[model samples]
Target: MWDERVPVHVAGDFYDLDAFRTRPDVLRDFETAEVGDVTGRTLLHLQCHIGTDTLSWAHRGAARVVGLDFSAPAVEAARALAAGLGHGPERAAFVTGDVYDAAQSVPEASYDIVYTGLGALCWLPDIRRWAETAASLVAPGGFLYLAEFHPVTESLDDATGTRIVRDYFARDAQVWDEPGTYADPDAETVHNRSVQWQHTLGDVVSALAATGLHIEFLHEHDVSVFPRFENFEVRGGYHRFPDGHPRIPLIYSLKATKG
Candidate 1:
């Protein structure tokens, strides 16, 4: 799955590797501020593609950081980027493995924080299993933090002007055969077949609750790290609905802790 998307992400300007390297603290302003302090803490990032965000956490004072991805090429590229950025193998490490099978390689309850970023959950088929694995990786009293694109935005059809084309509560597999990638809309690719699953807001909360993780906070916002649907306006670093647009959730963040 990720193997096909790695090149598209790296070469595209959306990730803005140059901007990230020059000013690494960009994302820290809005998304990671709620993560609190990670000084001397062990952090694990699931579906961490290319280690950009993982390295950012390490740069923010994490004692140790590990990034896991399903794509071998992504892992290799991430390691290479880390070495290039002077992170080396000591401060941060990258592993290639499925998010569902992450426990087979990493030990249980070994991390102080389990962090996942935007667009991570839709790639997954089972939210319950993903939450269970995430909960299992955190030590007692540790927390799990996630910032993801809201499912409400997923149901809208942006191509036709914010029409609610899909059901908001649908839990089904949606396949796309587009020729361009999100990162680079102009880049043409042959391996365009992609599979994704949509889970509702209730489904997400229930899945985490089932893992014995206590919900600390669940925040809904109109901002997104990236442009989600077409025709969406980007202002003040957030994506917003058009004038007099109906109320719809765009993004959400959840914080949970192991009891």
Candidate 2:
């Protein structure tokens, strides 16, 4: 599913590589502040779609950055992008593999920061395994940083406008057969049928804690990097609900350190 969406994203406004070529620091503002002082950090980005965020980290002063993805096309594109940006393979490298499987593929306990998710966790079925992989990748004193769509926010029915419809604590992967990619809703579609899971806020926190990662802070916000529902307003270079809409936590961020 992700493989087919690569070209669409590459050409779309969401992952604008043309703009990226001119501007190396295209990371979202909050992300820049949260993943602070990457000056000499070895950062690893898992489920990294096409390495924009990975390269963004590299540009922010990460000494070494690796982007891991399940899609071969995305990895190839990411490598090309990093090379084009002149970071090349020395500073920025991309690997094609499932995030869960990359624990063995990438040198374990090597990275200073393990990063994942803007819209990543939903695609995975096991938070337990995800936490373990993140924990294993970061060295002692290093941390796992994540910013994701809130499960509560995701559970609402956007198809018929915002309303509670889906299970917030669903234990199984939900099947989606919708056409079109998120980047281009009108484009010709491929691999429309995909599976996604829902993880509650509690589940996410517990999974990392169980892996022995100490929670630094868990912050929630009403804005997101993309419009997740109908009629959401774009503000501060992100998306949020208008003043009168039902207020809910649309995004959540957490930084957990490995002891």
Candidate 3:
């Protein structure tokens, strides 16, 4: 499914590769501030689609950045984009592999910062295994940082997000058969079936804690990266509910350090 969507996403206006080429900072202001400076750090980005966020870290002066994804086409796109941005293989590398096998798949054994970007966790079935695998790649004294859409939204109505229509603690996998990608909703395409699982904020934190990672912070925000709810308005590069509308945690970020 992800393999077929790579081309569409790369050419779509949602990503805007042309704009990114000129100004390659796609990261949110709060995310950069939360992750702090990466002047000389070695970072690894898991589930890195097209390497935009991965290369963004390199743009921020990270000594080395590597991106790993399950889709081969996405990896190729990322490598091409990195080269186009004047980043060499040594400075920014991309690998094609699964997130569960990331430790063995990546060129480096470990990194100073192990990052999992937004919309990544939902694709994984086992949060515990993900934490264990991701935590293993974090060098001692290093940390694993994840920014994801809040699971609470899954329980709310898709349109208005005002009422709950699903179980909040449901452990079953939710399958989606919708056509078109999030980048281009009107686009015509196949391979639309997707299986996803919801992991609550508690599930994510506890899973990392089970791997002996110290939870540094778990911060929730009212804004989202995409227009999750119909009532959401674009504000300062983020989506939020309009005035008089109730606010909910649309996204969250967590940083866990290995002892």
Best model per TM-score:
3
Per-residue lDDT of 141 in model 1: 84
- lDDT by residue (80-100, candidate 2, tens digit) is 898898886878988888888
- Tens digits of per-residue lDDT, candidate 3, 1-259, equal 9989999999989999999999898998878999999999999999999999999999999999999999999999999999999999999999999899998899999999999999999999999999999999999999999999999999999888999999989889899998899999888888989999988888989999999999999999999988898888988888889988989899899899987
Ranked by lDDT, top first: 3, 2, 1
Better of 1 and 2 by lDDT: 2
Q: Which candidate, 2 or 3, has the higher TM-score? A: 3
Q: How accurate locally, in lDDT, is each candidate?
A: 0.82, 0.85, 0.93
Per-residue lDDT of model 1, residues 116-207, tens digit only = 98889999999999999888898898999998888887677875236778788777789988877777767767788899999888888899
What overall lDDT, based on C-alpha atoms, would model 3 receive against the true structure? 0.93
Which of candidates 1 and 3 reaches a greater TM-score?
A: 3
Error of 1 at 166 (Å): 1.0
Regions more than 4 Å wrong, model 1: 26-28, 107-109, 159-163, 242-244
Please give the lDDT score at residue 206 for candidate 3. Answer: 93
